[model samples]
Target: MLQVEDLHKSFDDFKAVDGVHLSVEKGQLVAVIGPNGAGKTTLFNLICGQLQPESGKILFNDDEIGRLPPFEICRKGIARSFQIANIFQRLSVFRNVQVSVLSQQRLSNKLFHPAAQLAVNETNHILESVGLLDKNADVAGSLSHGDKRILEIAIALGNEPELLILDEPTAGMSPDETATTMALIQRLAEKQGLTILFCEHDMEVVFGVAQSIMVMQQGRTIVQGDPQAVRENTEVQQAYLGDE
Candidate 1:
């Protein structure tokens, strides 16, 4: 569903993303893993049109989306959650998703009706999918850190994206929260058939949930394979995983 070829991005003399290539099939949950400075986020930015690639191509569903703006790319069925939660902390959980639903429908300028009423059912469904339905009326800022992350995912789903990109979905959570979030991602891929691509530092989460893994280092893709094969890759161990 997504293809990136010969992608390169540089800042001054330093190359952040150097000749990276990747492909993700429909309904597959893939994980990108690497140490710091691996350029994982930079690759995501290029794919989502946050940063135009210095060269190479990005194709989503066979159309060249390399130069499209972020919103246009989102409209083309790509949505991403950031490393940090991005939501309206002041708004209720329901209203936070409602805002995205309105924006997706291009109803942001329509002040005639209340935003919460714009797509009530769809908003509720998104909340339910992320296990946040009961807290729909609660203030977003009052939720725990993990709940906040789930809220961000619900907001991303508000766009009804065909492909969801999650940047460090389980970043700062406790083990229980991380496990819950990983299971949620697996359910989304297996039951809902949502295409998911995520970057995670936690090896346990990456190996536990991802059907396939891509390892990057120094701005390049060094290994791409299933969990066992990637785990046994000596070069991957030497470079990042170490001999542990």
Candidate 2:
């Protein structure tokens, strides 16, 4: 479980996240839905320690972690994926995931290891979970756009995180691909018991998979509740219906 209180972040006097607060319970699939520049991603960065909040407190299971570094946050059972497809273009799919598993070991000298014999056991397991096991040996750059996004998810899963923060998990995908990815996320939360918090512009995806939704506007959370409640909210309807 995680808790954020009075979080605020700014860039050169431009406030991005203004006093946002929220909580994510264990095994809960929570969606942070909002218009662009609503501070969804900025709040994530603050939670994961990518950017320090101007003023706030972040507690992971009651342990204050606002000042922790990104790696420290990952070590504490939080992992994330970006809105964009971030993968090693030249490396094999297996190798790409292997890097994530290897980093968890905290062995500074093992960065260049082939990760073939060293990480195959764990890497293969994670790849299989994301449905990319068969393509382990293929060049990452050669995969289709949807596959690349799946690979990014696999990389994040390699950490075996307790709370996964996904930024636009269905971005840049066909309807079929979006459905597949949403199903995968739902399966992970329901079967694997992984807590999920994600930001998405796709209302269909958010409402389909998220148990709860948090709606934000101009760096503030306007409403937080069940998916149907958020859907019926006048503010959310006005702000996001036309966008979808």
Candidate 3:
């Protein structure tokens, strides 16, 4: 569903992402793991149009999207959540998802009437999917950290993306919350058939939920394979992931 070829990004003499190449298949979950300064987030920025790659191509389906602006890329069916929650603090959960629902529709036709009414059905559906239906009326700022993260996921889902990129979905959660979030991701990937690509620091979460894993170091992918294969790989052990 997504392919990145020979991707490179540099800052003056330093390279943030160098010669990175990977792909995410339809309905597949791939986890990207690496040490600090490995450029994992930079790769995501390039894919999402937050940062332009110095070279290489990002292909979504058939078209090249590396040069497209972020919003344009979003319109083409890619949605991402930041490492930190990106929600409106004062807004209700329903309003947050409602905004995304309206944004998706506005992309197709800005003149569509009553964006609120037009997006009502979708808003409720996505809220339920993210387990945020009951909190729809609560202010986003009042939710717990885990619930806020769930709200972020719900906002991403509002786009109905074929590919969903989550950065550290379980970050800052308790053990029980992490377990719950991991189960949620696994079930969502299977039930909705959503292609998921995520960057996670927690090895347990990565191993538990990802079918495939990409090990990155110094802004490059050193290994790519299934969880068990990656776990036992000598290079991975010598690299960052195996150290855990």
Q: Estimate each model's TM-score.
A: 0.95, 0.94, 0.93
Residue-level lDDT of model 3, residues 1-244, one tens digit each, is 7888889999999999998888888899999988768898999999999999989989999789999999999989999999899999999999888888877876435424455456778899999887889889999999999999989999999888989999889889998888888888888899999999999865667887899998888888888899989989898788753456
Query: Which 10-residue span in candidate 2 carries the lowest summed lDDT?
Result: 107-116
Writing each residue's lDDT as its tens digit, candidate 2 over 1-244 gives 8988888888998989987878889999999988778898888989998999879889998999899999899999999998888899999999899888877765426767654367678889889988999999999999999999999989999888999999888888999998899999998899899999999866777887888888888898888889889888998888875565
How would you encode candidate 1's per-residue C-alpha lDDT over 110-216 as one tens digit per residue? Answer: 62464336788989988998899999999999999999999999999988899999999988999999989998999988988999999986667799789889988
RMSD of model 3 against the true structure: 2.4
Better of 1 and 2 by lDDT: 1
Native-to-model Cα distance after best TM-score fit, residue 85 in candidate 1, in Å:
1.0
Instruction: After the best TM-score superposition of candidate 2, give how far the Cα of residue 191 lies from its true spot, in angstroms.
Output: 1.0
TM-score of candidate 3 to 2 decimals:
0.93
Give the candidate number with the greatest TM-score.
1
TM-score of 1: 0.95
The top-ranked prediction according to lDDT is: 1
Local distance difference test values of all predictions, in order: 0.90, 0.88, 0.87
Span of 10 residues, lowest total lDDT, candidate 3:
107-116
Q: Which residue pairs clash in candidate 1?
A: none
**Tell me, what's the RMSD of every candidate?**
1.5, 1.8, 2.4
